[model samples]
Target: MSSSTEPLPKLFTPLTAGDIALANRIIMAPLTRNRATHGSDAPNALNVEYYRQRATAGLIISEGTQISQQGQGYIWTPGIYSPAQIEGWKGVTEAVHAEGGKIVAQIWHVGRVSHVSLQPDNRAPVAPSAIVAPTKTYLESGFTAVSQPRELAAEELPGIVADYARAAENARKAGFDGVEIHGANGYLIDQFLKDGTNQREDAYGGSIENRVRFPLAVVDAVANAIGKGRVGIRISPVSPANGISDTDPQAVFGHFVEKLGRRGLAFLHVVEGATGGPRDIAPFDYAALRRAFKGVYIANNGFDRESAIEAVESGRADAVAFGKAFIANPDLVARLERNAPLNALQAETLYGGDARGYTDYPFLTEKAA
Candidate 1:
């Protein structure tokens, strides 16, 4: 909306974080469309089309791609460590670049929030502690209850960090402009950061500094594998998504952010409220958290055009990532620029589909085409 023909909104301005550059501040949040299993459990032409259609976004963060077989939790989600998987992503990166867009792969490791069926040896998933959550995972059939996990030994901790670094290298080879470490959403890293699930007495748990140690190690690994300027990390400080809770989110995340800021990564993307839930519940000092970090801040969850503009203008956030909006309106930047109506996303076809709600969503210019 910084264009003269459009509304002069802060969301339309150009911004850069470390090595990544954006023509605008509207980002396409990572989304799981769940069509990989029909192909090779890797990216295919369908995945290419889905991201290409949304190239209008300033930055596209790919859906959580498992760092290894052990990192996988949901069926049909892509992985980044295999040669074939890296090859599969080539078309996606090429297509996005062809449209003059920038994208990054989000490397993930879903810890105990997984099922035995999704594990490497049909064994229990590993975590900082052997805790089970009320979370459910999507299978080919439908959502199933999550299985309990085996607690990871202190010796095996470095191996998990190596997987993240390997995935970062694979993302680079796949032609991704960058890679984002999935340290949020009750995954392996989040499980260690928060005190609720991380009851271990090792160096990786108990106190906030010790809790953030592993996540910070992964950050260092990925930053060393790729350039620090090309690495980003996402965190859900207060979000209860996937049954994750922090005893002291402020102290925990404050220490986490302060530590991460020193790493000089590209940016920090946060799920402001419960991931995709109400924002006003149990408020925390988000602005202080924003100021604590010296790098770019992406405010996500329940953001619309008005709120997005307000956040940027008020200097509360440098960008905003939209999930459902980007899903329904691929050219969300254009729609927001002209302040136009959007095509509502078909709730049924959000995942595991051909192209109905995927690439077939019409742009504003194509409404009558």
Candidate 2:
């Protein structure tokens, strides 16, 4: 446990990447808090308060906002393509900025983690190959086993890249400081990057360069739409979530990160563990990947206060992002400054409805009484 009386180290150090300057090295990782309204997937008042409460972090990555209707994977996750949705996100950006916080929108596509009910006219989900994910997606109604996805034709690849570009434009319109391409956790981008899911033999698969083509194209398009200084990419090389795995992960991810570093993007966010499973099972080499990426690096996955601080102090990472911890500790920056104890998150209330475990968690000052 961290001691409250110890003199605080310079954990609140300022950082500069490209044109943006952050107040500290702690960031709030994008977390899906399935509180969007049914049917429309629009952000509600609770969503506003949820983000507003955690405005003290150096940077806040908004939950994975779907880039298109087909990009959705879970029920009640927010979207960025609609006017109402953009308006909702605008309010969130404004609130955070008012408190001197910077925010980035995470654009996503779920690929095969989607259900039939969520698909286009009950069509099969889309992927690089016709394979079903080895896992199921949790929904409001119930869990739905993943079905084989329709392999994307070469002609369809360009449009998917365009969708990511358009979403980056939408984030700019919604007043975000930047955008983070969600290429991690077995989502659409990861599905395209991993050989276990992408069995294509054309220009898009069969080799390490081919497997990373789609994700790189999407990143290039996004960086073009928004300036490279305002774009970041997140990736989890060994993630088993949503049934994604890569053979020769070192070669694949090493090439990916090296290429991204040349792009001069703002930062690279790496989730080092099996993001959705136990830590012991993850397979990527964080130290090797860190050496591969030359730009600013933000490390995520199962970090506590001391570990997070050590990561920065020891030069292993430029910053650290928190997921579950930020949910209960709204004033996380303040808590770290004061060396206060953190609030434990309730697993049941992570997704789905209302303020019970969402906006109702008290600050340490309030909890002390």
Candidate 3:
């Protein structure tokens, strides 16, 4: 997203994608604020208030909520699996809706990008292969070494897909307008898509076809459980964040993107760079993927207001998602609309805190009041 001098740029235009409609083109990219109930991993009042404050975004994709106990990676992030969790999220979706906003739950599973301490019963985190990511996972104590994970048994794949489907249904029951499968940022789905993480010789690995098998299966299951038109997916084609690398991201993601388009998803959010990092670390044909997808393509990562406007106007993206920019400026869309100065984000309080950096960011009206 880029900053601009002109007001009412292309970024503010309304758009419709499948069953979901946006009042503007600035989607709030899901940011893991780590403010959930720690022990239960449930969405709480803080999470509700945080999202409600940002309801002006065209669409608010909630922070990546784990789909199961095994899916958790870090402390204090919410889950959608348990009955209590579903009830918890009901408050959040209701709050957002009360403010006249649309929101989708970003269902996630961290795969090998986790530590034993984060897993149930201190079990090893599961992944496509037993590869240990050179990544660290945040624990209540602090960031700790990510342990090597157990390779998911071939028979266990279907259960994971089932979990996703159930989670999608749970999301709807929790009052979310839809669900966005967390297929990006080197999570479970990304682990299977990229060759570096998936080394299995079985039907779920080896060739690109085999590698993408489980991920696509998960998508189909989720789509069937929830209407395809209300489902979305997020992917990082060339990003090597979280110790993930692909031998050929272009070919791998090109194939994946084309297959995903065939599912008639609501939208496809593509992270063009390492998650929350630089864009030029690798060369990728984002345009090609956009052309291949044939649906609403949301370009994310490293975008300012002006660049976001350019992307929507130039037809490079149907919308642009803003992440960190939304942390401090809950009224981000309003500020962008008025071209107003922004409040600085409190970096120290970003991950875990009270309403200080979460919901206390004053709206423009609040400042005047």
Candidate 4:
């Protein structure tokens, strides 16, 4: 569709981020559907089909996979801890690979954004401080206010880091191409990073350097488990998702990104503004953060076909991750290439549901037929 004078657009060109090679720059962002196997909390046939349908994405970052039962905040999400869970995820990885797609596990730990019922033995959730987040977690009954959390002891920090490393290893064993550390959306790592939730005076929570210590440690351990090239991390500087905020995100994230640059990780997936909300909900310089990271920089949060092309063509972002768009369009890459209309999203089925909104989204070719 182009002449010799114009080269292929960067958005559709091949890219190598660390060890993972991609056919295009369009990526599928992690979306939690709460549709994992009910009792096991493992990926099942539905999950496998759901991902397989969207394998056209250059890369698929799996939903927030809990590293351990204690790390869970919502019901019916998948985990990489148990043997059965590992086997269950193997089916998913195989399906994605068979479709010639690269996938990564988004390893996660929800700090205080959890209900007591979701915690291990109904114990209180743990966080950097004992403060409860002004958020609600999805449960079997319905959405409920998150429970008060106990302050995590400094000694327990190593164990949490170890859990992340184990999850990375488990992901590789389950045939994942890599792992993406979930450091965004007011999750465990985000709780430790922001000043609002992290009121601890201990070494893990006082200053910016101290706050970023645990996240970096987890990065080190996960990279050690799998190769550094097989690891990426997602961060939200100003996103107040799940009631997280910082007094000065620019200074905090600037230093954090600078430290990440030295690690030579695969990529940095950043939620530029408010997670799942307005991109300009707060004033923060995402470009500065992008410049700080040395590897591929993935820009997320509210991007369309035109903006995606512009971001990649101008080198503002190496790639663009689409969440809701991918949910509504399985043949998103082809649709974007042809500038085709995307199917409307079924809002009610965004969370826990059957194939109606999950795998039943018709392909572009099917519409033509």
Worst 10 residues of 4 by lDDT: 1-10
TM-score of each: 0.97, 0.95, 0.97, 0.98
Tens-digit per-residue lDDT, 1-369, candidate 2: 236785545457888766578999899999988888888888878888889899889999999999988898888999999988888898899888888889999999999888877777878889899888889876877666876788889899899899999999999999999999999999999998889999998999999889889999999999999999999989988868887888777788988888887888999998887895565574557787677776779988898888888999898899999998899899998888767888888988888869999999999778879
Ranked candidates (TM-score, high to low): 4, 1, 3, 2
Can you give the lDDT of residue 256 in candidate 3? 91
| Model 3 whole-model lDDT (C-alpha atoms) | 0.91
Model 1: how far is 193 from its true place, Å? 0.6
**Runs in model 1 with CA error above 4 Å?**
1-7
Kindly report which residue stretches of model 3 are placed more than 4 angstroms away from their true locations once superposed.
1-7
Quality of model 4 by C-alpha lDDT: 0.94
lDDT of 3 by residue, 217-321 (tens): 999999999999999999998888898989999999899989988889999999998888898879999998888886789999999877987899899999999
Best-fitting candidate, scored by TM-score: 4
Give the poorly placed runs of model 2, Cα more than 4 Å off.
1-10, 276-283
Error of 1 at 188 (Å): 1.0
Ranking by lDDT: 4, 3, 1, 2
Least accurate 10 contiguous residues by lDDT in model 3: 1-10
* lDDT against true structure, model 1: 0.89
The local distance difference test score of each candidate is 0.89, 0.87, 0.91, 0.94
How big is the positional error of residue 111 in model 4, measured in Å on the Cα after superposition?
0.7
